[model samples]
Target chain A: MKQGPLDLSQHFLEEGVVDLSSSEKQSALEELCAITSKHAHVRDAKAFCKAIFEREKLVSTGIGLGVAIPHVKIPSVTDYVITVGRSEAGIDFDAIDGQPVRLVFMIAASEKQTAEFVRVLASIVKLVKQNDVRSRLLEASMPNEFCSILREASR
Target chain B: MNARTLVDHIRSSAATGRLLILCVIIGAIAGVFCVAFSWLLETVQYYLLDGLAHHESEHPVWIWLLVLPAFGGLVSGVLTTKFAPEAAGPGTDAAVDAYHHHGGRVRTRVPFIKMITAAVTLGTGGSAGREGPLTQIGGGIGSFVATGLRLSNQERRILMAAGMAAGIGAMFHAPLAGALFAAEILYREMDLEHEVIVPSFIASIIAYSIYAQKAGWEPVYAAPHFHFRNALQLLAYAALAIVLAASATLFTRLWRVVRDAFSSLPVPTALKPAIGGLIAGSIGVFVPDALGTGHHLLAGAFASSFSIGFLILLVTAKMVTTSLTIGSGASGGKLGPSLVLGGSLGSIVGLVVQDLFPSLEIDAGAFVVVGMAGFFAAAANTPISTIIMVSELTGNYQLLVPSMLVCVLAYLFVSRHGIYDAQLVSRLEAPSKMGNMLGAVLKTIAIRDAANHTRDLIVVPEAMSLRQIIDLYTSSEQLAFPMVDPDGKLTGMIEGRDIRRAIAEEGVADLVVARDLARPHEVIDIESTLLDAVQRMTLTGLEDLILVEAEDPTRPVGVLEHQEVLHAYDRKLMEK
Candidate 1:
């Protein structure tokens, strides 16, 4: 597939996992925003990437155990959205434990959707915290399998 | 005291009781100051010209008048210039400026200097009143007390205004009116300094009682007994209001013109008052009653009537002499002169109307009383206080309704301008109130007015590559971008900054998808306001917010940038 619009499933479509082409946190954010632009309603791709990077600059969003959640409240989007970018090769996201990040969850929201934005973030954090879910997400090799695992974990 | 201690003192509730006690002391001091000031001015006049009144010298004793005023002015000028330059002009202006700008601080020496200078000015027949000096003396006492107590600026202002009320109350024996004047005179528009009202009343009453112990508890002016017999008399009073307001407007403008002329004179500043005294002294040579505060003349006008022509001439003479006296920096209050003019104008109208219809029992004294109130209302833009003050001055409460009618009419007629340059339009315009005004503006303005419509935004697809985004960024001036899914459901926003970062990272752009790289931003519904947007923005540390269709949260409408909201706020304020 020449790759349809950057869908939620498309993020994990390539062998159910994405490789970290970027070396560091900043480049990883840039790469993720660039690919996400294929489907996200972003007016400016670079702005979207920089906003997430700016959020990352305050404190490393890399929670630990090879997971990072980078988010931004920007004027460009009309709704809350979540995209998962798996970096199998391991990217230097400056995780709390000083470990490289393997799973990257980038969330984008409008300035007004505060309640939904917060709720979605909490859900994402909860889903990522489950040991079985993390193992399943790490083991999945197909887009359907990853999507099913995320759906179950989210529920 | 150190800054921290001062701040702590101001924050404490104990300061309020301390300030109230201080106000009582200042009021008593101001009352005594007024009495002593009046006595000194009288003594000076007695020594200067009163003794010469019965002189049998071949040379007309009036010849001594020519130099007496000039001499008084010269001495007054020297005293003011040498001791307290702020005490030079009508003291009320200095006191007003002190309250508005100087944190309610006046030099401790000002009241003493003003007393001596104003005494010389009036005693030597400088054609001025005692109220101006009394006002400064009272205000100085308030400042002295406040400074001694180490009170906060707010407490100082209250006491200062109270002191002023005390002085005026003692001088006129009208405590209520004095309190009202202190609160009302600081602003040109119909705004009262409400915080000072209770303190001012307390001070004024104390001062009035103390002063009345010496001056006797009688009204300042005595009027012939009169009653509002018929409703038709209201028409005459209404006419009096219109005419007096016109005269007062003319008087106010002329005073400013004369003051400006004297200000531009090339002579030494100290000699300016002397020159003004010379002209007033020459006029006084003929109409000596026009000199001093015009109290005696104003009293006479109310007691009896002169010919219409003579009364009119007295009005003109009093106006000219007063403008010369105070406008040229002679120490005096325009209040006394305004009362004299109003009385003279009223008596003239009474004479004409009485002559026109002999059947109508039109009391000229009633007109005189009404004129005093209405004229000051026009000049000072203090209708309620002027009416009350005039009634209190004449010891007549029955004339309240008529006086109120005329006072209000006169005030409305010429209230567009005022004699006090230090007067602000209202508390809203005061420097202290600006922060509150800004808060009010932010709270009141809706997002609909502040937001930039979605159609005005630069929209780009979520699937667009970083290279394509860079191309769009260079082409458009938009700072915000709304990302959409394949179904066109609004998914995420990409600020222009993020795109630049992507391009800056070089090779990372090709590998990363826009959806995964996109950051989720807060969305504002169309129905929300700027206050809501600002609150959310502050909470999330965001500068710009996306607006969505109210019916559908997922549908992008417009962008509400922080800068745009601020611009709208500015426009709204300017409109106000």
Candidate 2:
């Protein structure tokens, strides 16, 4: 089968766009991983958090401008998946820009998905760099609104 | 050229004289190279980045900014690939790998190629630094001098480390730190190359003094004296350490990512650096401060002149551009860029903490300096030397407490894979040290270690006939059996070879008794090491040795197999 760029919007089921409840950085990650654990790609939320946090230790995915992308590659994951978590009151993520992170995009990829992983990483970095996309994502109130914003951005 | 020893070439009577004279000569030579390399780098960097860019400031010189770095990368890539392939990329790896794996012998032309390539790579606005490549250059100087003199491989490796220390010491103007760095950077853990320490110190101090005498003794960055005031504020420093550690991990991982990406590209190796340079130049067109060795950023950080936004931009841009510069196989070091990135992140952390607490009276510039130490400590996996190096770089000993604390915390927190690809986890893990460690470790284990296995021996009665002994040997797997007297006292031993000879004489199989076939055998004392037993077996052509008490050497109590001694060593090696 031929592989192409993943439609990030299509994967964003409204339920996957979680409103982060915790103020602390560790808990915020836990909340995202927990919410997305029900997906087929993520069988265990604890395991997902463990792998992603281990990677975070290697390098924080906190790209500057209030956005963070915590990602991991695990053998248990069958494919690639993206789970979004937004916080109104930003949490300290040790961001390169010294800004508190408000938007956390948690990505889980199968261990075999090397090329797809890079493409997904590039897409996320590029998508957040767009001023309108980032602003709309931050201001996004409802889960449906979040999905639409990503869909429009992906298009 | 094939002269294998210094004595062969020099015809010296005094070996001590030769070693001392060579040590001093290598240090002086390394010192001179450091000054020359620094001069060439400054001249070229000024021509491309500052001198030329400022001269054409009135026009749209952005094109020049883009072209200059790409051109620099192309020249460096071509030079290294054409002449000395080992001279390519961040140089510390080659130097370190040489000491561990290659017997410290650098190719004759690598040093010369590295110097020129590093100069062009760093000077023409590549976001890499001078120090990393300088290690290879200096190490080459040592290797070359030792090769010419025909020094032993061990002595040659020591000189190589000394040269590395000298180059780093001269460039940073931090002699003590450079000396320590030479020892510390070899391993990822908190271990040092103890043998290299004294030699590195001697070379480092000499190199630092010579460079200072020629280039002035001024510290690289000027800063106001910053002291640790509140013990409570160490919490803030800890936070800074975490941030620095995280950023350091980011720097190393991103560096690898970029390098892998560039290497994996289908283009010829000679042209990959140019592509990386083009992208980096485009970034430089907007944020010009991000290019080169980052002295400007270092200066700004020490002056406490950064807004959070500005510092953040510099940090991000510096990380990306520096990665591109070094990752694309352009010959330069990431150490200097790491210092800048760490300081920027630290400066921002300091600002935020000071604003949040207001009463802590936190000095933001202090964090910049501390960040420099902490970040390098984490990324390079050299904590102790980094603390001193940053202190010496800023000429401020007042912040030693904070610097040391931050460095250690960051070092402990960083990932196992640091910026250096060649660093081993410990001295034991290094191949150069393994051969010598084997015998020394085995000697520590006594025969008593395997005392439990002695109880399961097969004892042959002295009264038993040769036929009975032959039947027992055929049924059981014992190669040798302990022969005993009729009174059940241990006497001697009978091996398979003796049994075979006895049985070959036709009627003797039933005629000879166990006592007749028994031969007086070598015995090992309980106090002896496994090495001793094995050595005896090799010398006497014995398959097994009788174990005797050290106090009673006449009486044989149990048997010790050659295989058991070997098994003991195998278990011990695993522990080591």
| Most accurate candidate by lDDT | 2
Candidate 1 on A50-148: residue-level lDDT in tens? 778756655567777778888776777665556677776788877768898889887777755543343445456656777888888888865567777
Q: In model 2 chain B, which range of ten residues has the least summed lDDT?
A: B503-512
Worst 10 residues of 1 chain B by lDDT: B504-513
- The Cα error of candidate 2 at residue B14, in Å, is 8.9
Give me the chain B TM-score of candidate 2. Answer: 0.82
Model 2: per-residue Cα lDDT over B412-488, one tens digit each: 99887899999899998988887567667768888878544366667887657667888988887666788766566
> Against the hidden true structure, what lDDT does model 2 obtain?
0.82
- For candidate 1, give the docking quality class from DockQ: incorrect
Task: Give lDDT tens digits, candidate 1, residues B516-564.
Answer: 3456767988677677787898898777788887788887788787888
| TM agreement with the true structure for every prediction | 0.65, 0.66
Model 2 chain A lDDT-worst window of ten: A1-10
TM-score of chain B of each: 0.79, 0.82
